[model samples]
Target: MDKRDLVIRPIRAEDIGAVQDFLFTQLQELFAQDGQAAITDDVWGLGKTYLEPDNCNMWAVFTPEGTVVGTAAICAYNGRIELLKGRYHLPTTAEVGRCYIDAKLRRQGIGSKLVEAMTQFCKDHGYRTMYLHTHHFLPGGFNFWQKQGFAITIDQGGSLEIVHMEKIL
Candidate 1:
């Protein structure tokens, strides 16, 4: 498909239901393959909280036909990490989270575009830094973030397992 066929836009309130459905569907498929059930209602509730306007900023990637094929979010919050003491960091740094692209559209550059759009949005909103945590198990995620100029800022628990990366906007 031509790159011009894709469009990225800010997510609206009405898109929340469809986005939640998409995420639940994907999670269900993942658990079923592992002989487990879909996530519990409480977990879904927490996800809803994260997606709420008070907690996050969200955007959706759509096809020319208007199908919502991918989603990305940035959560603004405060943390008290000792490493940040007396340093120049935004009081409202944004953390990228809940990025998902339709399985059928994987490797079509949709994810990368969505992330770039989100980062640009953060910069426009006066945020100075962006961060995200990703599991090493996800193929290409680590490398993708690195290619986008994010560096590993923290490796929690000394496991070098779950990585937290950051980029200054």
Candidate 2:
């Protein structure tokens, strides 16, 4: 649990597989609960996309032995900003998602460390606000974002209810 025992850095090409497996495993569990397929949008495995996109970045938290324990992303999703801008008067927003931490490692501060790194990355990249979309299905989704200073802005229920949250940053 010591800070020095972990490293947080931009994900590399080789990291895509392990990170993808980690994320897909989580998604699979959710899908199984609904008796659905585990497959998700193909973008989850695209490490190069995260690297080459403008104002987009992702990090993987690794143990001293180099096992990836957590991940976070800050991406340029301007299209989603209109929803917040029209309603909340929020400024330019960077979208943050694709964050996951190995369940066994939860409560050890790895998630916070990833978020801190992404926050610095966003600030350095000139983002003064952030937006994230999470559904109630995601474990600890609401509370975690709230603890990170994000407030729930919208939640719409249909076949699925997506929660939208924002932070002034």
lDDT of 2 by residue, 1-169 (tens): 6657788899878888877776677666554665555435535646655777768888888888777777788876566445555553233567887788777776667778888888888888778887887777767767788888888888865545578888876
Residue 147, candidate 1: Cα error in Å is 1.0
- Residue range 1-169, candidate 1, lDDT tens digits: 5657878887665666766676676556544553555434522553464446454677777677766777777867456455554443546588787677777777778788888888777877778888787656455667878888899876663433468788887
CA-lDDT, candidates in order: 0.69, 0.74
Per-prediction TM-score, please? 0.73, 0.82
Residue-level error in angstroms, candidate 1, position 160: 9.9
Give the range where candidate 2 is weakest over 10 consecutive residues by summed lDDT.
83-92
Q: Pick the candidate with the highest lDDT.
A: 2
